[model samples]
Target: MGTWDIGPFDNDTAADFSYRVDEAPDGERADVLLAAFREVTGTGDEYLDADLAMEAIASAALLAAQCPGGEPVTTSYGPKKPLGVLPGELRPPAVAALDRILAADSELLELWEESGADEWKAGVLRLREVLTGA
Candidate 1:
């Protein structure tokens, strides 16, 4: 259960509050990573406004890209659960946010490639496509 504190962001309420990554549960690495992304970006709950949701998506992308090996290591305050299936209301905003983040951050794409997170990236892409198409 090792942990790494990445850094604090302006969205965070406390200066000491930071994004962190922790070891994944068995057979749940991808879901854990996704959850981590949402948690770190402030989108883990149902209370987010559209703006915060967008920020969360961008932050998640940044974390995924910056993550070493692109594995699921991010952690937050809560019981571990699968994030592969997001609520319907969140899909549209998540897609838009991801698109915005991807468009703005070439480095994240490069990091996704470099980290060999093909499956994770593909899943995200699929989610984006589905949300956009719907």
Candidate 2:
């Protein structure tokens, strides 16, 4: 997985995803994020792979950063280009994608559990809380 930490952009896949987002045109940046989230939420109960989960988590972090209480994504691995304010509509799908990533069949979830990553799990939950504004 090439993961070094629990942050959304801490891994190679997510770092690559950040570049992808940066390369996207300003008007289409939100679409890029939406696509990542949908890749997980649209998979239903299928086993979610780590890379997909990573991208979705990155996307959610970007969206959440725009919320009132949400923290900004200041990591170097996060997108270099500013995404501007994403639409409020993205929140629901971002939450759904997070749910899917934490679900039983998700490879990312299993990997974290096997590694006894309580902090990682908590970070994901924090992302969810930011997304839902709870």
Top candidate (lDDT)? 2
Query: Which consecutive 10 residues in model 2 have the weakest lDDT in total?
Result: 125-134
For model 2, how big is the CA root-mean-square deviation?
Answer: 0.9
Encode model 2's per-residue lDDT on 1-134: one tens digit a residue: 79999899999999999999999998899999999999998888788899999999999989988997898899999988889879999999999999999888999999989988799989999999988983
lDDT (C-alpha, whole model) for all candidates: 0.39, 0.92
Per-residue accuracy of model 1 over 1-29 as CA lDDT, tens digit each: 01122221223321112222224444443
**In model 2, what is the error at residue 68, expressed in angstroms?**
1.5
Candidate 2: residue pairs that collide: none
Error of 1 at 10 (Å): 24
